[model samples]
Target: MGDEIRTILEQYALQNAVKHQDVPRAGAVIGAILGKHAELRSRAKELNAIIGSVLAGVEALTHEEREARLAEIAPDLIASMHEKREKSSDLPPLPDAEGGVVMRFAPNPSGPLHLGHARASILNDYYVRRYGGSYIYRIEDTDPKRVVPEAYEMVREDLEWLGIAISDIVYQSDRLGIYYEYARRIIGIGGAYVCTCEAERFRELKLAKKACPCRDLTVEENLLRWEQMLDGTFIEGEATVRIRTEIDHPDPAIRDFSAMRIVNTTLHPRVDATVYPLMNFSVAIDDHLLGMTHVIRGKDHIANTRRQKYIFDYFGWKPPHYLHYGRMSIEGLVLSTSSMHQGIADGTFTGWDDIRLGTLRAMARRGIRPEAVRAAVIEIGCGGTDISFSWDNLFAKNRELIDKGSDRYFFVQDPVHLTVKDGPEQTAHAPLYPGDEERGYRTITFNGEILIPGKEMEGNDLIRLKDLFNIRVTGENTAVYAGDSLTEIRAAKGPIIQWLPPDQTVPCRILTPEGIISGVCEAGVAGCVGETIQFERFGFVRIDAVADGCVTAYFTHR
Candidate 1:
C-alpha cells in the first residue's frame, strides 16, 4: 500500500514540479493527494515524510526531466499540466447557473452576525461574485419575538465590514401585506386554511395522521377566520393559518405546519403587527418574490425546506436550487446571542466587541481580516459533513494576509529592568519591516538600561537582545552587556529576546481572549493606532488606541 501510494504521490509531485518549472510545492502535492483520498489523512505524518523524500528526488531533476518522468508515470496528465486549473477546488459551482443567478443572505435581525453566520453569507456572496449578479441582503425580522431593534442596522454594519456590498436591501417586516396576499391566494386555492384548533389538539391529530375540524372549513369560512385573525378578533394562540400537506407524511412536523399566527402589535419594536408569518412561510414567499435563483444554507433547515416546498407547489412556483451544508462547530468561542447579551448586561463583557465573543465585530477588533474569515469559511466549502473547526485555520490565513505589511515593534510583558553593567548609551535602529530597509526604520535611544520580559530570565544565560547588543544574565533583574556580534550570539546558542529602552517606551496593554497582557512598547508604536503590527518575540496585535501616552491594543494572533 505504501509503494502504491508513493508511486501515485510521485506522479503528482512530478506533475506539479513540471507545471511550476521548479521544485513542487509540498502543500499543493499533499493537498492533491488527500483531497482525492481522504482516508489516508490518518497517516498524514507518514505521508508527509514520504512526500518529503519524493520532493527531494523531484527537485534534483531539471524541468525537462520532470516532464519526461511525469509522461512515463501518467501520460495523460502531461497534456493538461499547462491547462488552466479546475475551479473544482473552490466552492462548487452553483447548479443551473447559466443565465446569471440571483442569491440572498437572509439573516434574521436577532443579534450581530457571528462566524456561524459567515459560512452561509460567504458562500452566497462567493457565488454572486463568481457570476456577476445581484446579491440581496434580506432581513427576516417578521418574528417580533426574535427581533432586536438595534440588530437591524448592526447586521448591515457587520456585513459591510466583511466586505459584502448589498445590491438590494429587503425587510420582511415591511412585506406583511405581500405575505397576506399570498396567504389569501393559497387559501382561495384550498391549499391552506385557518385553524381554530387548540395547539395540543392539532399536535395530537398531526401525530395520529388525522385532520382537525378546521380541515373541512370552506374557503369563504377560512378567509373569514383569516380576516378575524388579521382584525385581532382572534387573539394570540386562538387561531393560526396552516398550509395543507399530506397528514400521513413520514415527517410528522411537515403535516400542516403553521403559516401565520396572531401576535399583539405592542410586542414588536419596529412595526405594528397583528399577525406574523412563520419563518419557512415568510422565507419561501420572499425567496420566490425576490427571484432568488439559489438558496445556500445550513443542513438544519432541511425540514424547513420540505415545509417551504408546499408553498412553492401550491403557487406553481419553481423552487430555487437549495444547497445545505453540514454543521460547523467553532471551537473555544461562544456563538450564543442570549449569553452574550446577558454578559453585556451583567458586565461580564465590555460589549459586542469583546474578544471572548465570536461576533465579527470582535474578530475585527482583534485584527482578523475579512478576507481571512471568508477564505477560512470558503476552504470549509459547502460540504454536508459536520466540521470541527479550530482557530488555527483562521489565524494562519490572517497571518498570511498581514505578516509582511505589518510593521514590527517590541513589547515586554511583566517587564523586568535588566541593568547592563557595560552597555553603552547608543541608539538602536530597527527596520520597520526586517530586511526591507527601503520601507524605513525606527530608532530607540538607550542609556545602558532596558526592559526585558521577566519570563525564564535565568542567571548566567547568554542572551541576544534582539537587534541590540548581546548580554549575559548575571543575577535576578540584572545582566551585563557581553558582546554586539550576531555571529557570536548565534554561536553561543543563547535565547534571543526583545528589549524596550526604558526611557523611550510607551505603556501598553493588549487585550486577548483570555485576559489582558500589560506591557510597554517602543515610543514609535504610539503613532500606530488603528494599525496591525507584530511585536518582536510576541504576537501580532492591532493598535486600538493610544491615549494619555499609553498604548492599548487587541491581540490578533501569533
Candidate 2:
C-alpha cells in the first residue's frame, strides 16, 4: 500500500489523542493522508483493518528472530529497501540513516552546463536524499552534432564540485544498437516505414499538401530499405526510418517522424557506430532498459514524448513518467546553441567555463555554489508554457537558499596608501565583516612608518589613502631617494597600509582568460578559494582557484 495509509493512521491517532487529552504512543501509527475530520473519523474503521494487518504482519515476523521477521514482513519494507539501494549502495548501519529513493540527472553533453543543468542536478540530488534513493548520472549524448568532449567533462566536473555523486554512469550512445534493433523490429511489425523524401517534401507531405512517393511501399520493401539505409547503402539524408503513424495526426511531431537516420559523417561517442539513431528512438529504448522510472528533461522535448509513447505502445512496454521542464533561459541574453558552438570554435568565449557564456563550470568558477544554482532553477519551477527567463531574478532567488557567509579580505586593484594618526600607535586588528563574531578578524600591523614623497610627522591629523586608506598624519615630508631622485613627500593621517609581515606574505600570480595578474597574500588566507568576498583596499574578488605557488584569480578590472 502507499504511504497514504500510514499517514491516515497517524492523523487518526493524533485526533484521538487530542480529543482524549492523553499522550500518544510513539510507536502508534497516526497521520491522515486525506482531508476532513468526519471523513477521517469514518475511515478509522478501514484504518483499523490496516493496522490489524500491519500488526499481524509484524506478529508473523516475531518468531523468525525479531530482526529478520521485522525486515521481512514490515509494510513498505521491500520498497523502502529498493529505494535505499538506489540512493546509496551502502545501507546505513543506523535505521534512521537509511533512505530509499532513486533519482537520475541526465544532461545532454552538447555544451557547457548552464544554470538550468545545475538546477536539474540539484533537484536529482535533493530528491534522492529526500526519498532515500540512489542518484544516477547518465549522459544524453545522442545528438552527435551537438555533443562535445569538453561538455561531457564539464558536466561531470561541475556535478562533482557540487558534491553530487552518481551510483552509476550510463550513456545513450552506448545503447544505439538496441535502439536500431528496436527500429528494425518495428519495421518488421509494419509499425514503421522508410521515407526518402527531402526536408521540404517531407514538410509538404506532413502538411498534407503533397504525397510521399515512398509512403505506399510494402512492409518488406520498407524493411529492405531500412536495412540498406542502416548498412550505409543509402546516401545520407536520402532514407530515414519513420514510424508509421496517421498522416493527419494533430501533433506534427508524431506524424511519421524519423526513428533512425543515416549519419555517416562522424563517429558516435558512446556507440562508435557509424549509423546514428534518432534521439526519440534511442531515449525510449534506453530509458526502459536502464530501469529508469522517471524521465526528467526540458519541456522542449514534450512533443517528442508523444512519438516516444507511440514507440512504447508498438513494443507493448510501459513508458516511464515524464517530467518536462521549461528551458532555463537567461534574460537579456540570447543563448543560441549555434552561436555558442561558433564561439567555442572561434575562441570568442575562452572555454566552456567562460563566465559570460552561462556555463555551470563558469558559474562555479565565479563562486556560485551548485545548491544556489539549483535553488534558483527550482524557484523558476516547471510546467509553464515557454516564457523568457529573468537572470536577475534567478540570482535573487539563489540568495534565498544560499547562506551569505562571513566576508574575507579581497584586494581588487592597485594599492593605495593611507596614513593614520591618533588612532592606535600600534597595529589594529580589523574584522573581515562586522557582526561575524565567529570569523573574528585579520590583523593589520601599523609600524608608525608612513611613506610620503617628503613629509614630517607632528601630531594628530588625517592621512587619506588615495583610494583605500586614511591614516593620521604623523610626520612631515621626508626625503626618500628612489634610484637617483630625492622626492619630497608629506605624511598624511588616515588608515595605514596594513600589510602582512614580509615573511608571512607570499607572492601570488593570478592567471585568467585575459592575462596574468600579480598580488601578495598571507599563506593563512590561501584557503579562501572559490569564496566571493572583497579584499580590503582592493576591488571585488573571487577565489577561482588555489594551487601551490600558482593560483588563478578573477579581477573585475583589467
Candidate 3:
C-alpha cells in the first residue's frame, strides 16, 4: 500500500487494536499501532456513524410517511451535511490545504473576459486558493466558429490583470478520447442512443408532444452509427447521439436531447485533431475526469445540468455540487455569447466592454467594479433559467456601491474663455473628488485670465472655480469665447465647480478595449492605464494605455 494508505491503516488499526490482557509487552504493541493509526481510527468512527445513520434512515423510509418525515426535517438536512467549511482570507491560497477542493474557471473564449467572467474567475480562484485546492483553467471552446485564439488570450490577460494565477490549464479539445470513452460507457449503460431524425423532425416531435422514431434505436445499431459518424460515413446533421430520457417529465429539458453531432466544420480549435465535437458530452466526461468538485456557473446553463447529471449517473460518478448564478442580461436583449460576438462585429457595440452591451467586460468598462457585480449576482440569486433583466436595477446597484468610496472630477463639456479685467485673482482650489478626506485640494490659478462660461463677461463680477474661492472679476478688455465652451451662463444658483490647472500635464487619449476615448485631466489624476476611476461630471473612465504625452481612456457614460 502507498504511504498515505499504510499510515492510515496503521493509525486506525492501533486505535481499535485488541486490548492486552496478557502483559505490558502486548499493550505496548497495540499502543504503537494506535499511535500510528490514530487519524484513520477517528475517520473510521465518523464513517461508521454516517453509514449507520444512512442505513437507519433507509430502513425507516421503507415504511409509510417517510417522505413526510423527510419534508419536516428538510430545512435542517443540508445544514447537518458537513464536509469542510474553511474559508481562505487571501487571494491565491494553496489548493491542497482546502480539504481537496478542486475548482475550475471554464470560459467559452468567444470574447474577452467581461464583468461576469471576472467575477466567476475571481470567485473560483479565491475559493481554490483559500482551501489550498487546485484551480484549473479550462477552455470551453467546443463550438467551432466561436473559439478564437484572441478570445483565449484575452481570457488569460483579464485574469492576470486581476491577479488570479491558475495552474493546470486543461482544454476540452485535448480530452476528446476520454469523452468518447465515457460516451461509449454511457451507451452501454443504455442511457444514450443514436438518433437519425432531422432538426425539424425533432422540433415537430416536440411541438406534437411525441417522441421521435430514432429515440428507440437498439444499442448495437446506435454504437455502429456512432462509429460511422466518427468515420465520416454519416453526414453532418444526418445523425446525432441522443441521451435516452423521460419525455413527459414536466420539464422540457429532460426530454431526450442530442449529446453529440457533426458540425461539419474544420475551423474548430480542436478540430485539427479530428475528434468528437459536442459540448454536453465533452463537458460531462471532462469534468468527471478532472475531478471537479463543484460546478458554479450562470443559471442559463442549469438545463444542461440535468442532462449532465444523467451522464454522471450512467457513468456511476457522483455529480459535483452544482451552483447556478444569474446571468448578465438587459431589457430587450439576451446575453447570449453568440449574440454578444455579433454585436461586437456589427458595431452594435464597440467591443465586449461596450457599456451598452450588457456583457460582463462591458459592464466593467462601463464602471461596474468586479466586487459590485458579484454582489449584484448574489442579491439577484439564482432563479431557474429564464430571466428578464432591467438596466435600471443593475445601474442602481452599481451606483450605490460606487457612490460610497469613489471620488469625483469636473469635466466641462464646452469650456469658455473669460479675460478678467483688473481682478484680485487669487488661486482657487478644491479636492480632486468630493468627500475625500485624505485627498488634498488641487489649486487652479485665476491670474486675471479666468475662462468663465461666457463671451460677454464684462457685466459678470464673480468667477467661481467650484468648491474653491469665488473670485471677483474686474473689467474686460475685448472678451472672446473659445467657441467650444458654453456661452450662455445663468446667474449663480448652486455651488461653483472645480477645474484642473491648464498647465497640469493631463492625458489626451485613453484607449480601451471598447474604443478610443479622449482623456480630460492628468493621466494619474483621472486614472492609470488599465485602471478605473470616476470623472467628476463625465461618469466612469477606464485608462487603457499611455503614449507620448497622451493617455487613452474610455468614458463609461452614467
Candidate 4:
C-alpha cells in the first residue's frame, strides 16, 4: 500500500507540475489522489505522508530539471493528461437532461464566425452530444441590409472545422410564412398592434411611458393593416407590428417592442418578402416550433429574453430553459465584425485569415487546432462572469496539442556566414523530433561552412552546433574546429546554436505578428507546404505557400 501510494503521488505531482509549469501543491496532490482512490479516504494521514515525500523530491529540482526528469520517467503523461482534460470538462451538466433534448446554434449571417461566436456554437454542440440530443444549425439572416451572402457558406465551413455536426439545418429566410401566421394570430388575439408612427415619435412615447395612439386600434383594424403590410401597401419603415406589454414596465424598451417590420426584399440575400420578423419574434417562434428544450446565449440578450417571455405568455406556450453566459473578450483584439470587414476592404488587413485577426479562420490559418479552441472554451464553461484572457492563454493550449507532431528545422534570419577552418567534412543527421527516433532523421552535409543568425553569434566565443559538433569562434566571422567531444561541450555549458549548411538551404519568409521576417532555412523545409514545424530557438510556424524558389510560412508562437 505504501509503495502504491508513493507511485501515485509521484505521477500526480509530475502531471500537476507540467500542467501549471510550477511546483506542485501538496494539497492539490492529496485531493487528486483521494479523488481517484476513494478507499483511501479514511487514510488521509498516510496519503499526506506520501504526498509530502513526493513534493519534496519535486521541489528539490529546478523547473527545467523537473521537466526533463518527468519526460524521462513519464514520456506519455502530458499527452494523456490532455486527453483527460478534454474528456473531463468542468462544464456542469444540464439540469434534468434526460430524453429528447434539442438545441440549436442560430447565427446571424452578418459576418464570418469569430471566436466569440465559436463559444456559443461549441457549448451548444457539447451539451447536445452529452445528452444524446439533436443539434440544429440555423441561419438567422432576417436583416437584409447587413447580411453577407458569402458568410452563409463561411459559417458552415467554420462549424464543420470545429467538428460540430448539424443534425438539422434551418434558414429563417425560408420561414417568412410561419412568422406571418404567428404575427397574425398575435394581432387577432389583441396581443399585438400595428403602429405607423415615425421612429422619433415611438422613441418619445417609449421614454415618456406613453402608448402610441395606434396601440388601442381594434383587432380587426390591426388585421387589415397587417394584410396591407404583406401586400406591399406599406413601404420600408412605414409601419411595424409591435407586441403590447405593460406601459409602465420598469424597462421602457420593453413597453412595446417591434415584432415585425418592412424591409426591401430586393436588398436581402435570400428571401423575397417586404415584411420581415425581427430577432425576438422569429427566435421565439422558431424555438417553440422546433421543439428546442434549452437556449444558450450571451447575457447581452437578457432584454431579448424578457421580451420573448412575454410573447410566450401571450401564446400560452412554455419558454425553453435559458442559459446565459457573460461576454468573452480576447486581450488586444477588437472582435467587431464591421471593423474586420472594413479593415479587409481597405487593405489594412490582408484578409480574414490574417494572423492578427481573432476569427476562427485566422486561428486555423495560424496553425491553432480546433480542438485547442474547443478545450479552452470548455475549460471556461458557462460562467456568468465575463472572461478576459490574452492570446498567450490560447497559444499555451495550442502548444500542447501540436508540440509532439511539429518537426524541428533550422532557420536563420539575416544570415551571417561563418567559415570554420580545419573542420572535418561529414554528414550531420538531425532527428525530425527529439526523442521520437522512429520518425527518422533529416541529413545535411557540411563542408565546414554554415550560416547562423547574426544575433546568436553575438558574445559567444564558444558554441555548439546543435546535434552536430562544437566550434570555437576565433574571430568576428570565422571559427576553428573544437574537437568533437560531447562531454567537454556539456561541461563548458555553452549556448547551443542552430546552423544550416550554406549550400543546403532554401529561401524562406515567415509572416510573424509583427511583420514579415525574410531568411534562409534548411533544405529539408522545401517540400513541407502547409506543414507546421519549429524553427529551432525561434518559434513554431505553419508553411502557408511554396512558390518562386521560396517557402512562406506564418509564425504561430514560440
Candidate 5:
C-alpha cells in the first residue's frame, strides 16, 4: 500500500507542476490522490507524509526536468494535458461557488487594458464562463484628470479582441445619480457626514486621530452642505463627505476616510458631476448593486478591501468574496499604463498598439493570440506568490496553439544573390502547411538566380536549399550547385537554408521588438494579410498590410 501510494503521490505532484508551471501544493496533490484512489482517503496522515516527501523532490527539479520526467513515466498524461491546453481551460473549482456566480471587471478608462488588468478580467470571465453566469465590464471613469476621451472606445476594442464576452457594459460616469442616492442614504443614516475642512487642516486633524468640528454637525446641516456642493456653492476642494469610522483608529488612513469629494465636472470627459464617490465607496456600492459574487484583484488592494468592507458593514450589504492575487512581473512586458501614456504623449512610443508596449493590441499585432494569453495566465494560476513571467513559457504556449495552422514561406532579409551554376531549371514545390498535403503546395520556378538571407552566405560554406538541391559557397557573394541528393547533405550534415527565386519575390518589412527588419518573400506572402505565417528559418509573423507591392508584417516569436 505504501509503495502504491508513493507512486500516486509522485505522479500527481509532477502532473500538478506541469499543469501550473509551478511547484505542486500539497493540498492539490492530496485531493488528486483521494480522488483517484478512494481507499487511500482513510489514511490521511500516511498520505500527507508521502505527499510532503514527493513534493519536496518534485520542487527541486526545474520545469523542464519535471516535464521530461512526466513524459517518461506517463506520456499519456502529457498527451492529454497538451490536448486539453489547446481547448478550453480546466480551471480549479471556485470556492463556495453557488448556482451561477456573477462577477465584474471594473477597469479605469484611463488607458487600454494591459496584462495586469488581463489577469483580473480574464480570471473573472473564465469563472463566469465555467460556472454559467454573467460577466460585467464596468468603466470606472470618475477621475476626470486620468480619464482619456478615446480610452472608453479603446477599452472596448481591446476587450473585444481579447475574447472576453461581457454580459453588459456599465460606465460609472453615467451612474452618478445612483451613487448620489446611496451617498444620501449613508448620510441620512448618520453613517457619513459632509465636512468643509480645508485640506491641510483635515490632514492634521486625521493625523491627530481626531475628527474635524464638522463631524458632529446635525444631519440637517450636513444635508444642506451636500446640497450646496451639488448646487456648486461649495466649489472643488472646498468640501468632502467623510464616512464615519472609529475616529481614533490606529491607522490614520482608515480614520473617517473621505467617501465623496468635489471635482471639476465640466472638464470631465464622460460626465458632468461635481460630487464623486471615492473608489472604496463607489466600488462597494456597485459590487452590491451589480450582484458581484467575487472580487479578484491584486494583493495591493488588501487595505482597500478592508476600507470597502466598512461600507458594506454600514449598509448591511454583503461584501463580495475577495481574492487578492499577488503582483506578477512578466520579464519583458511593460504593464505600467502611466508610463506608456507619458511615453506616447512625449512621442517615445507610436501608440497603444506599438509592438514595444505590453497592451493586448500590441500582443495581438505580434501574432500572440487571445487564446494564448488566456492559457498563459490560467496556467500562471491565481496564487498570492510573486511570480516572474517567462517569455519562453508564453512563447511556448503560443507556438503550441499556432504551429499546426501557420503556413510556411521563405523570407530573405538583406537578400544576397546566390548563383546556382549547374542545377536544372526545375519548379520546386513545398507544402503551404507541412504534413497536411490537402492544403497543397506553392510552386516556385527557379531559373538560375535565387535570393538567400545575407547571414546564410556569411561562411561561403556548403548548404542545402531545403527540399531542393545542395550548394557550396564558391565566393563572397555566391553559391554554386554542388549536388541534389538528401542523403548527400545528410551525410555531411550541411545547413539547410531558405531560398526564393528573385522573380517570385515581394518586398517585405517586419516590425520586430528589436527593430524593423527589411526583407523579400515569395509573392504568395502578399495575400497573407490578417494571417500569421512562419517565415522558414526565421520566426512567425502576422501580416499587417500590403501596399504598392510592399508587404508589412510584425514578428511574433521564434
Candidate 6:
C-alpha cells in the first residue's frame, strides 16, 4: 500500500511538473490518490506521508531536471498522458461505417451560427475526417418568413473560420423539385394523403386516435388534391400533405405527421413555389438522395427521427445511422435566434456580433480562438443528457492555448505618474514571450518617470518593477530607488508591479465582458490589429482596430 501510494503521487507530481513546471498541490495529490484507491481513504495519515515525500522530491528538482527524471523513470506514463489528452477531444468511431460515410451540417439560415450550432458542425466534421468520409453543408432555407438574406453567407463564413472543410454546399430551396417528386410518389403509393380538414378539426381527430375523412381518400383523389395544392387552389394553412403512420402509436406526435404544406411563397426570401416540404420530410428525402450514411444532431429531434424513419420505410430506403447528443447551454448567454433578432431590432443589442451574445461572430470578436471552441465542444461529445457550462470553463481552455503565444506588454489603466528619485537612466528590455528567447524582446528607456495603474498603488510602500529594479513608495506619486539585489527583493516579498515608460506608450482601450477599459500600452502595440496579446498582470486581449493614436482591443480572458 505504501509503495502504491508513492507511485501514484510521483506520477501525478511528474505530470504536474511537466505541464506547469511546478509540483502538484498537496490537496490535489491526496484527493487523486484517494479517488484511485478508495481503500486508502481509511489510511489518510499514511498516504499523506508518502505524498508529501514525493512532492518534496519533485519540488527540489529544477524544471529541466524534473522533466529529465520523469522521462527517464516513466517514459510510458508521459506517453499515456499525451494519449489520454488527445483521446479526450476525440469522438468514438462510427459503428458499421462500412463503404464510404457521408454526413452533413444542416442549419436554417434564419440567424448566424451560435456555439450550440457549432457542436453539431464540429462533431460531424470530426467524425467525417476520422473515418475518411465526406461532409456537406446544407442550408435549410425552406421557411421564407424567418430567413435572413445574409445568414446564408454568415453560416458559410463561420464554418470556414472554424476550420471545418465542407466537401459540398447544398441549398434545400434549390431542391424543391426533388422534394415535390418524392411527395407525389409517396401520395401515389398511398403512403401519404392531402388533408383539407380545418386545422382545429384535424388536431381534434389526431388527438382522439381517429383519422380524418381525407385519410382514406383514393390515390387518384389525393393526387388531384396535391395538384390543386401546387396550382393555387389552396391557400396557406388550408391544406397539408401528411404521411400515413400508425394512429394507435403510443406517442400522439407520431400519428400522421405533416410532410408538405402550402406556404406563402411571396413571403419566402428565395423560392416562389407555393408548396414547401416540412423539415422531417425534406431532410429524410435529402439524406437518402444525398447518400448520407450518418446523421449527427441534438437529441431534441428524437421525435423527428421517428417521423423521418417512416419516410425511409415508405420509400424502401435505408435510414442513416443516427447519433443524437444533448443540447448544450452556456450559462448567461442568450442563444435563441428570435430573441437575438428582437434584441437587435429593439436596440438592446448592437448586432449579431455583440460581445454579450453567444454567436460565433461574437466569440471571434472577443478574441476567443476557433481551436478553443472546437476543443470545448469536442470534449462534451455526443451525450443524451443536456450539458450546461459557464464562460469560465471556456476561458480556462482559451487561456491554455493563448498564454504561450500572446506577447506580454504593460497596460496602465487610469494611469498615475510615478517619479523615481535618485534613479539612474537605464534601458529595460522585456521579452515578448517568457521562456521563448528566440522571439526576442522590446525595449523601453526609463530616465526618471513612468506610468503605473492608480489602483495598484494603494497598499504598497515597497514594490519591484518587474524585470527591473526595486523602489520604496514614500508618497502617493513618488518613489525612491531601493537597490537591485535579488536577495533583498525576495526577502522583502513586495508586490511586483508592471510599468510603462511614458515616452513609448500608446493610447489603448479594451472591451471587456463587464465594460470598456481605457488605458495606455507599449508603443510596439501599434499595427498589431487582429493580433492577440497579453496585457501584463491584466488579461489577454485581441487588437480590434488601430488608428488615431489609439489601439482598440477586446478582452478575451484573464
Pick by lDDT: which candidate is best? 1
| lDDT of each residue in 273-359, candidate 3, tens digit only | 433546777788878888988777777787889888888877788877777666654454335677877877888776666655555
Candidate scoring better on TM-score of 2 and 6: 6
Q: Could you give the C-alpha RMSD of every candidate to the true structure, in order shown?
A: 8.9, 19.3, 23.4, 6.6, 10.0, 5.5
Model 4: per-residue lDDT, tens digit, 437-488? Answer: 8989989887888988888677767777877788999888899989777556
Estimate TM-scores for all models. 0.82, 0.63, 0.64, 0.85, 0.81, 0.83
**TM-score for model 3?**
0.64
**Per-residue lDDT of candidate 1, residues 325-441 (tens digit):** 999998777789999989999999998899999999999999999999987888889999999976887887787689878998889998999788988877878778855779798
Model 1 error, position 54 (Å): 23
**Cα lDDT of model 5 by residue, 88-153, tens digit:** 457667777868888898989889988888888888888998888889999998778888889999
Candidate 2 to truth, TM: 0.63
- Candidate 6: count the clashes: 0
Instruction: Name the candidate, 4 or 5, with the larger lDDT value.
Output: 4
Q: Can you write out model 2's per-residue Cα lDDT over 68-182, one digit (the tens) per residue?
A: 3323445354244324232232311222224354457877887766665666777556556655656779787877777777777877877787778688888777777777788
Candidate 2 segments exceeding 4 Å error: 1-103, 132-135, 332-338, 385-407, 410-426, 433-532, 536-540, 545-552, 555-558
The lDDT, on a scale of 0 to 1, for candidate 4 is: 0.85
Which runs of model 3 end up more than 4 angstroms from their true locations?
Answer: 1-98, 123-126, 129-132, 165-167, 206-211, 273-277, 326-336, 346-350, 353-410, 428-443, 453-463, 467-494, 499-552, 556-558
lDDT against the true structure, each candidate? 0.86, 0.58, 0.58, 0.85, 0.84, 0.84
Residue 328, model 4, lDDT? 81
Deviation (Å) of 97 in candidate 5? 2.3
